[model samples]
Target: MKDVYGEAIFDFYKGDHSVVLTTHNTYGEPEEMPVEVFFRDHQDFTELENLAITSCEGKILDVGAGAGAHALFMQAFEMDVTALENSPGCIETLKHSGMEKMVNQDFYAYESKYDTLLFMMNGLGIAGKLASLPFFFSHCKKLLNSGGQIILDSSDISYLYEEGVAKPNHYFGEIQYQYEYKGKKGEWFDWLYVDSKSLVQETKELDLHTEILMTDEYDQYLARVTGF
Candidate 1:
């Protein structure tokens, strides 16, 4: 976690969620890892950052609103916004930030509908597992307002590969990663990188249409919510 805002700014200092948390290395060695933390300050973000997301104004739900940056952006646009995060510590921070609009509820249990579902920063992994797409859609659908939209930002590692050049027969994810934290090189980072068309194809099965909302070379999609 970065030390800017929201991730670590809890009002009442409390204990952590009791999950058997541990960080691992590419070698699969275990190292103790601390919880991620963040903090929010209106002064940290520039004016351009505010303008980027404000263009979409409606009842917005900012999922995985790390540090409340996007939440602040939506609030500036005068839109009704609700920020939900799974971390209890992150929630406590937002609660005391004096922001009444933020909520700590999990999306699985959230009952309200939203016109806009804004997700960024690995939020596409809300399903947690690849096969959980249907499960994710089932729970997340309950929160969509009529004619709603899902704006998800994720990276397409396929873009990282040059065209026509065959990728390694082995999974690129198998090339383990090294983490240098707590004065050690550790932690294997293996997570799926959804291809641009893969998510589009998958979403279509659920009767939704996805398009490249914005992409320079990196592929991001504005997954439009349609039938079902």
Candidate 2:
């Protein structure tokens, strides 16, 4: 897969004020994703994001830590935080941002224990699909310390489908997307946006306890998962 996303991140970080990253969905329409969104500071975070930030405890792992925005905030309070990112270009941006600890490895493949796994920006979408929730939960079990919490946010996305609209046979939240930057496109990938009910059901089966921390006006929610 081409690192179109990383290139965009690096470009934006390097002061490319006009850099625009676009994502394509099944609808064949390109959705503009402003690269600067990843660079937002704490003041610019949404209510749900603020909840996720305050929920962090002990050693923290900022999963999919693009641009190191959240990690930079945590550092202000002398909080132990690590920025985990797989994008090489983003890694350069993180280094340039003066992050104390940054790891360049796939989330599931990285072995480490942390009290809080902060997944902002719908980072839970890394699960790819609904059927893979168990695998995602299982990996969280390995990465969390005893009584650790997984603080993340996700949207319902069910509203995208109408009452009588024809939907795919699979879960509606399992959306496919491709990133394009400067005319170069990356490979398509599956991203999940699980609803609250489905997320609770999956956690229940694994004996994990989930608590809804907050829900924004757009139906996006912040959740805390523990009892691992």
Candidate 3:
């Protein structure tokens, strides 16, 4: 609840080049990744992110638009884009970085409809758990206009069990994460990383059509889902 991650992004934006993210996950030891807020441009984007951006059309909503990176990319093309983020500090950074439209609100409670809902950086993890997929789809249905599409990315995460390790009792993709910056630790939160096969099956039950847009060697993939 302290928005430690957002604070780090804001600090990096304010010229603190030493900011880094310390992430603790259920499946692994703590890892440190440098936070390069000011330097995140189109060149730093992955293939999946590029595919999603080029495929976007009409009005767009970039969910969890941290540092406004994806939204900024779309804005460069003069696309109608809104950067939606819940972090106040990140929102400040987004505004300072010249994001024309920024919203400080949760994606689930957002009511506007858009031609494209863009979720990058494993954005679908916001669904939290496999059991929440139905509700996630239902909410997305309400936020999409006619012929709209949801472009998002996530990893299979099955590689964690390749060493003959026992999987968690719940779904494999259901993960817990916490963030640490400096000497402070944030609260733990649930995140999901659904595989492509399971995503297709779940979408079918929701009456939505899913397409595997791209898959990399690392089991991370981008998917497009269209409402009925």
Candidate 4:
């Protein structure tokens, strides 16, 4: 996989704070993401993010911990936090940010037990497709300690389709994306945006219970999964 996303992050942390990362989505025009967003302080976090952070307990694994922002916040309260990132460049950035503990490994490939798995910024999209949720939850079950929870945020994205229009045969939330930075384009990857209802159903089948913790008008929501 192209490491363009991590390269941008490393550059921004190294004083190129003006860098902007662009993403080309399968269903929409390319979107620009500010590198600074990865470095947000606790006060700048959205209500959903703050809730996810506070809901965390015990040994916490910040999955896909891009720049270590969430992990750093948990560390402030002396929480046992470890950042798990795959990108070497982002790992370098995390080290420079003074993050105490981090693992440079892919989520599924890394084996560990955690009381809380934090997946902010739609981080659960790593599941790629709706069909992959079972495998995703099974892995979550393996990695989670007894009484552990998975705290995550995602968007419904159903509104992206017209009311009476014919939707695609595949799930609308299964989007393909590519990242671009400084004229470098990354490999395309699949990302998911499961609606709350479907998410609940999927987890239920795996004997996991999903709670809709909070939601906003934009169809974005925070959720917690337990009963693993």
Query: Which structure among the candidates has the greatest lDDT?
Result: 4
Q: On a 0 to 1 TM-score scale, where does candidate 2 land against the true structure?
A: 0.97
- Quote model 3's TM-score: 0.96
Write down the lDDT of every candidate, Cα atoms only.
0.57, 0.90, 0.89, 0.92
* TM-score comparison, 2 vs 3, better candidate: 2
In model 1, state the lDDT of residue 59.
Answer: 79
TM-score-based ranking, best first? 2, 4, 3, 1
Residue-level lDDT tens digits of model 1 in 1-228: 322222223422233433223445333456543333233355554333333365344778888776576786567657788888766656776665545587677777778878777776546766654556677776667888667777666666554446554565653323233334324333343444455676778788877777655553445433444443
Off by more than 4 A, model 4: 163-166
Instruction: Please give the RMSD of candidate 2 to the true structure.
Output: 1.3
Give lDDT tens digits, candidate 3, residues 1-228. Answer: 799889888999998888878989998789886788434878978887789899888999999999988898789889999999999989999999999998899888889989999888889999999999999988988888988999999999898888776789999999999999988888999999999999999999888989999999889999999964
- Reference-based TM-score, model 4: 0.96
| Model 1 quality (TM-score) | 0.65
The alpha-carbon lDDT assigned to residue 58 of candidate 1 equals 72
Of models 1 and 3, which has the larger TM-score? 3
Name the runs in model 3 displaced over 4 angstroms: 37-39
**Candidate 4 residues 1-228, lDDT tens each?**
779999999999999978989999877779999889999999899888888988999999999999999998898889999999999999999999999989999999999999999998998899999999999888988899998999999999888787654577899899899999999999999999999999999998888899999998888999999996
Order the numbered candidates by lDDT, best leading: 4, 2, 3, 1
What are the clashing pairs of model 4? none
Show the lowest summed lDDT stretch of 10 residues, model 4.
159-168
- Cα lDDT for residue 152, candidate 1: 67
Window of ten residues with lowest summed lDDT in model 3:
32-41
